[model samples]
Target: MGVPVASGASPLDAHELLRKGEVSRALVLFEKMHDPRRPDPAVLAGLVESRLALGEAHRVAPLMPHLADAALHAPSKDHHTGLAHWALAGLAELEGDHDRAAGHFRSAGEAGPDDPDLLPWRAGLALALTRQGRSPEAVRLAHEHLTRARASGSAYARALALRTLAAVDGASSRRDLLTQALEELEGIQATRLRAQVLTDLAGVLVLLHEDRGPGVIRLLREAELIAVRSRLRPLLDRVRRLLTRLDQPAGSTAPPGLEGLTPSELRVVELAASGLTNREIAGRLVVTVKAVEWHLSNVYRKLGISGRKELPT
Candidate 1:
């Protein structure tokens, strides 16, 4: 189903809306321009990205069939086909299918120009790998991606690379990377991307020095403001979820420097520090390995460590 492209409604404006984090408006224009019988690849790509950005996965699910048409259209400077795969990778990541997301991210590079592979998909792939417990390669790939992004001289690319690196890295190095990302992003008007980077930077600040964390509440608050202003439901949900996870209950005394952690998280840390594998700890705690990993990830962000091996015995 396609509505007539509105008079003077340029696709460039739609793309710009995405860049500015005005995804709801971008989606409207893309929808008006899409024609199923002779689909526009750029429109299809934009539609998918905009829908997913707004947390409208259910909307995109039914429209997935239209994505294939991206390959059938001429390759624009935007590399519509590559973007289709890239957007699909994001959708898979949202669905918690990192294996599937990794595959699509790789295919995104092979599709053609738009050169997302060199700029950002490698970082995406690295994150997907990290989620699957392939940390060694993930770290290597993300660092390499950041290096390439720096060499390419695109601040936006560098910011994207740094943000992903921040996620995959297990050390205090992340704060510097996140700080650099915020600086690079400062010059760009990519609102949605900036919001995410801000959130990451704020997370590092919170877990590492709880005493100083709330002082930088401005960052997370700013991100939340952006999400709300843009009607970015998914981003808003993520921000709230993060706050909920990090918040301590009233009167619960967390260990020094671990003020954001809950009693359950503290228990996980204790078991992990005893030289037990995540699996071993999960069994003892009657929780999933992912739960253990999540707790350990928080600890690593604060303590500059990796997994159990780095924890004190």
Candidate 2:
């Protein structure tokens, strides 16, 4: 509905649709173009990715061997080959094969180190390293890629780099990196990636334990809402699991910047911290947007913060 791309759509159209979270539409396009005996590696990879994102693990499992075979026959320098490897890496990660995933990600990276299109490979490798308990190396790799991502000025790249850094920096720092990642993701209209980042941010908040209980709970709640709205089952389940952990009783401690605020003001502050715009917050609360803005203004004044970005997470 957003774009008339389905008519005579190409793989690029499918890719764009996938980026926009129209997984079913993208799948239709890919299925129309796919050949059983000689599948295009790029389209096959995209199909695999869409299925995985939709929580169709059974479907993706059956497709894996074919996708791998296609990747095997693909040329070394072919970008489609790299994409196939990237899809394989994702599948490996899903199966908890960190070593294999890292290897595949490395292959993806080698296929096009400076192609300006393999940021996902770099980010995936960094995540794989973190999962393998190589956080220091992950941090270093992610830092280098963060520099490149910043230079690219692409929000997606920056969000990935920020998420990677947040994953690697779990124990060493507070929730700043993950918070920045949330801010970056919130600015984008990509629901799928935003849900993923929200899930990651919830996990990071649980690990950090630096934020107040109320605020952390609020952030996780927002993430759960988004995950459910986006139908991202994996992230939705994760947010639910993390919320259980947060619900367990812990020592009560209110984080700074929230002192002396009424419950209404506090709620506004929490929503803002979780990266919702005033209009969104109003819609969520069934209140007027002007009322939401007024509440946020009071919250900022009380917290001595100037903007939504300055809200404490």
Per-candidate TM vs. native? 0.69, 0.71
Find the candidate with the highest lDDT and give its number: 1
Worst 10 residues of 1 by lDDT: 248-257
What is the number of backbone collisions in each predicted candidate, taken in the order shown? Answer: 0, 0
lDDT of 2 by residue, 74-169 (tens): 788777888888889999999999999999998888766444324367788888998999988887888878888888877767777777777676
Q: What is candidate 1's lDDT per residue for 1-313, written digit by digit as tens?
A: 1112345776667877777666755776776677888766667778888878766677777656666556435463346666777777877898899998998777776675534323267888999999999998999988888888888877778888889889998963888888888899886777888999888877777678742346456676677777755557777776766666557222223434555666676666655553456886687568999998888888777777765566532
**Which stretches in model 2 have alpha-carbon errors above 4 Å?**
1-5, 113-119, 170-174, 212-214, 248-313
Top TM-score model: 2
> What's the residue-level lDDT of 79 in candidate 2?
77
lDDT of 2: 0.70
Model 1 stretches astray by more than 4 angstroms: 1-6, 9-12, 69-78, 114-119, 210-213, 244-313
